[model samples]
Target: MPNDKNNKTELPRNPELTPPCGPVKGQYRKGISSYKGIPYAMPPLRERRFKAPEPMPPWEYLRDCLKPGHTALQMGGILVDSPGTYQMEGKSEDCLFLNVWTPATNPEERYPVYVFIHGGAFATGSGTEMMYDGTRMAQEGVVVVTINYRLGALGFLATHGLYEEAGTTGNYGLLDQIQALRWVQENIEAFGGDPEQVTLGGESAGAFSVTGLMLSPLAKGLFHQAIVESGSIFSIASFAPHNRGDLEKSMTNGQLLCETFGTRDTTEDLYKLRRIPGDVLAAVSMVKSDQSVTPKAFCFWPVYDGVVLPKDPVKALAQAEINPVKLLLGYNTNESSLFIKGHTNLGIYKMLCIEIFGPEKATAVMEHFPVDDDHTPLERMLEIYTHSAFVVGMVMMAKKYASLGEDVFFYNFDYDPAILKIVGLNTAHAMELPFIFGNGIGQHRATKISNLSWIMQSSWVNFIKTGNPNFKEEYKGQVLWPKFDPEKKDIMVFDTHLSNKALPYQEDLAFLEKIMFGNEESV
Candidate 1:
């Protein structure tokens, strides 16, 4: 067996496979052997054409698997602004790859595997990003695999228009995830992982994907447990009926924009758009504040494609129609404060007026999330966008899933107070990730190691291993997180210390629900 002693050493033999992608590496303080950038499916470019993910053929020679695959298309703002160690320089349509980290190559040990799907609203992100390195988790005695599925125009372009022969329609990216899971089921044994003990996990859109997988017939028996951070099955970004109109509008706008950007010219003209350099495509696809909240800026979200997605995720979970997978789901304290659009000082009502009714109705929106002289416009703005967009929606989804009698765990991540102060982003969208992964990310990161990070990471690992999250140590320092019960209405608030607090804003959620359901009296 190869050395599994420290983070600096490399693994010994690959008698099971071909030449390694890079020298085997270790990470964190724990001993884990890692192989990066292994392809799981055929790329979705050119002739592959919106078809379901096809199997990746084995290589005649050993393929070095050290580096990560190219990230799918996304804006450079996120990746470039805070680039990390695993950042690949470029992207391509042929980017169907995955990475693995394991404690040992001994198949008999059969460690439980943790698969992380990255989030960029399904239009961006990759398994290769440094934020998702599996070395720390692997050192903790779990095998970790990160994957890159297609994204942007390549991944979710809704091929129903041209590829009727394909078994699936929209959500090629999701189908790619299914194929990756299938790869793990069949081949992870070779990497010292037990396929039977797979756990699927993600954040933001990635967490939303986890929820999607739980309901997917294609993903059944592929995973045993799930962890969702700062996101839920019914998050307001773009998954539900209210958002469907937006997606349709976005798609129509996207098609028109693509045509404007020269992506359409008969079926023959489509090739020119596809052939456009990625940077150019990325430039054209960028969603800016200047764009109208119309179809052109479509969020490129997942759809309820009957073949792959089957039904609305919430409806599936509500009726006990989904696969019987255990779940750990939660949202951050201030998710919207991180991604606030337009000026930071606008009041909530004004922002909503801009988002839903456009700038012309800014005065009218103030009637709903009206501002006062006492509160700053930023405060009012944060309240409006955060409440309607993320916070209230997450709480409702957690409650809906808990009502099902399944073992659903809920949390609110309010940690990283120090980092929040540093970055002026209070517990924002992806702050919990570096804490959980704990691989020492960017230079400006707040790094006085918190026991809370350890606690949450261990809880995630425990859920992956045993389908339960009560760690032996969790009860030692904090309030033991009770399983979500509808009657008690208990939820664990994960911050400096864990607490089983009654939800503080039930009435606000009620107000949002009334608005959604058209209870005009309440509204």
Candidate 2:
């Protein structure tokens, strides 16, 4: 156990600890000891670029983990200025670092672990982002971990030559995530974390990663629980221009990228691509257009690489071939508001709908969210995207988990702060993040935001600790969050007052289910 002596003089100012990987020095702050910028995998540069991450070799010296490390190479301005904004500085290809925040570093003290993955559409964002600081969550009695994985073409380019060399191509970012989890499994105990009690959680693309990891055989037994916020395999299936997990499209994109880099898809060219500067590769891989608006938005996304991701996640989930874990997942009410911006008339909205769902089904889907006096074209478009990209997908995942007799809890985050309301992005995508991390809210509405944050953090911690959100004594009088039932579709609505209710868009989701899943009774 950590020394309970609260006096500043009683604690070591700079603590040195030894984990399996190496001895590391960390700083003590507020009641938590943070070990930042711990390298979990070898630098993915030069010969290692576009390859599976190699475990970082143990060091004989005491490594300095006091400062933040480099983030995966990515283009700037990819993140929005919402609560979800992340720092994009100190970018590099040698970015396989993870940070840990723990109340104590006593190996005997086993606290539940919460490993967070950042969301950036799989192209941007970093674990070192200020918004992802794990101090507050660590204060709540659990060890918190955040990680960095390679992004964009540097992490996901797939090609025939690359496959011949590595036996698989693409999904390298996913492989990076898996490597991070393996590190947690091997070393979290030194940070006073119970590796067996680790809960993998994320929002948006991170949530997409949680689902991806759940589907990957390589990630099995890495995490015992999952908290998927605002995404699923269904989100990727609904949003990606090509089919979800389409390796062929990824390979074609890789060939195009090679051509863009003035090289052919040869073994020698693979070596040449690795030698190119990281910044130049990141700039070349940037997705210039808005993914939500552009139907053919070409981006460096994960592929169904036969090794890392053996098959399409949606198909794997449908076949009940997923890692069995207690699930707590949901989406915000206005998840699409962040992505769908600028001049969007009814014509563009209709075209986008037709592009996503075929012309035959587009008309039917439009009828569900019609533009009238109360609803503008933009409002309708955002609503359609919110449901299609986030809500329906989460609900489908919840139902599938429930069918498998897994402990699944579903939620709908509708707590809209006044600050966001003034900007017309109420309860937008990643709005729940501030509450979850207990940071980023302005002081004007501090009390209300703090109250919601308390509820979110407490519930999340409880779930991580016991696999049940309603396990705490304070939640006894409140509406008991019930397990999601496929028939009833029970949803825990997080708003001014917490309530257990039926899902909001039942009929719409059923229609979408039919459209997306071809009227199959089984999801």
What TM-score against the true fold does each predicted structure earn?
Answer: 0.83, 0.93
lDDT of 2 by residue, 426-508 (tens): 88888888788877754233476676677787789889888998845654237788999888888898886788888887877
Error of 1 at 312 (Å): 3.5
- Cα lDDT tens digits for candidate 1, 230-254: 6654553323222452334434544
Could you list the CA RMSD of all candidates, in the order they appear? 5.0, 3.0
What is each predicted model's overall lDDT from 0 to 1? 0.64, 0.81
The positional error of residue 303 in candidate 2, measured at the CA in angstroms, is 1.1
How high is the lDDT of residue 120 in model 1? Answer: 72
In TM-score terms, which candidate is top?
2
lDDT of 2 at 148: 93
